[model samples]
Target: MDAVIIQILNGLDKGGAYALIALGLTLIFGTLGVVNFAHGALFMLGAFVAVSVNGLLSLESVTLDPTKLTPWGTPAEIRTKLAEEWFGTFGTTLIDYSVPVSIVVAIPVMLLIGLIMERGLIQFFYKRPHADQILVTFGLAIVLQEIVKAIFGANSISQSAPASLAGTIDVISGVAYPTWRMVYFFFSLTVIGAVIAFLQFTTFGMVVRAGMADRETVGLLGINIERRFTIVFGLAAIIAGMAGAMYTPILSPDYHLGMDFLVLSFVVVVVGGMGSIPGAVAAGFILGILQSFAAMEAVKQYFPGIDQIIIYLVAIVILLVRPRGLMGRKGVMET
Candidate 1:
């Protein structure tokens, strides 16, 4: 029982990320009618944000070799000055702060990146076929991944929480667990909550939601639907970026982390319904919990392969019964 409880808690963290990414995908599909294959790249960009923030936060004094430290070839003075300025100005606390601190920087950066992407690239693809969109976005995903690898390198970068967040704590007597994962789980939930609240209550979200229902109709009301969509794209990017930013400590920041979640995010989007916010949230948790539970030794004993595909297996079953999705409309795709 205790083990099952642990897995359930674990699954929620995974599910939270899925829900966030899927929500972004759904927003684009629901509004723009463009099947964005590059959505994963946005997820990747989000993770990369963590890498960037980590780099900045972990700025260190350059170890200059006497051979290169000379004025002729080396900028040793500049490097020394840089390290001191960064640590002194930013405070050395960031040196030991958890990776999740990147969320602060990731949000605005992602939003700006999203806006640029939508206006600069995706806007042109809006009228193209899903195939073209996918091809372009697929290529774009590769390009984005390569860029991340080039900058951050293929090796994963790790960050640890502050000393305050380190070590295990007693959830129960003799049952202490790692503290960072718990912190990540909570941080992710908070992001999800804020996003949901914005979508549920904000005026901009209301407009975006209306556009998602029917852009042509929304346009008829004199709203510049395209501008709203650009913002929505950015919002989605923010969500994914924030997810990746906070996720740095758990899995570390790898160039490939975005691709890892892409397919599952798509599955979550489909399983949740075409444009149903509640459904997306629900499906994310459902799949997350099931996958976590299936990872247990007991479930594996009964169904050997369930551990490998329990989440996807459930997705297939849901699609089989509800071709439109659990809460998807009959023709939301057409609209």
Candidate 2:
């Protein structure tokens, strides 16, 4: 029973990441009507943002101490974090909670990147073929990844959760879970809920939905639907950025981190339906749980290496069973 509960928690934690990434992918598709293969690169950039913030916070100054000598008679060197020297305890706190702090910085940075990408490149592809969209965006993704590799190198950089939340919490009798994972799960829920609320209840969202359904009619109604959709693209980038930033403590990030999650997230997007936000979220959690269960010893004994292929296997089965997915619209992506 405890093991089952633990696995469920693990599933939710993993699902939160999948859902967040998939949600961004769906938003961009629904709003822009453009396939963005570069979306994963945005996720990678977000993780790098966190890494950059931490590096900035930990910036150090080196000084030679004349009073202290090394074994070889050279002066000892003293290294002090500039943040700590300048801000004292607050700086220390900032360093400890860098992951959460990075989210604040990622918002504006990612929004700007999204807007630039949309206006500069994606706008040109609006009337292009899907194959063209895929090719160009894939090329863009490679360029971005190579840039990251050049800057951060190919090694994985580790990030630690805040010391305050680094330990485990008891969820039930004989079941303990890491505090950060729990925080991440709730954080994901909060973000997802906030996005849904913004779309469901806001005037801006209503107009955007109308645009999605009948873009020509909305344009004829004197609404700047194109502008709004551009903002939606920025919003999607922010979502992916937040997910990647928060996930750093859970997964050490490397230059190719975005590529790692790219395919799985695309799978989630497809399974959730081409443009269905609710469907994407649902599929992410469902697949996450199934993958977790498949990784268990009991399940592995019956089916070797099932964990390695569970998500893809389930995606195939789901696509075969429900052509339009669990909550997909009747005409969406239909031939």
lDDT of 2 by residue, 42-72 (tens): 9899999999999999999999999999999
TM-score of each: 0.88, 0.98
The residue-by-residue lDDT of candidate 1 on 273-299, one tens digit each, is 877777887888888888999998888
Model 2: lDDT to the true structure = 0.90
Clash counts for all predictions: 0, 0
Report residue 163 deviation for candidate 2 (angstroms): 0.1
Residue pairs with clashing backbones, model 1: none
Model 1, position 275, has a per-residue lDDT of: 78
Q: All models: lDDT?
A: 0.78, 0.90
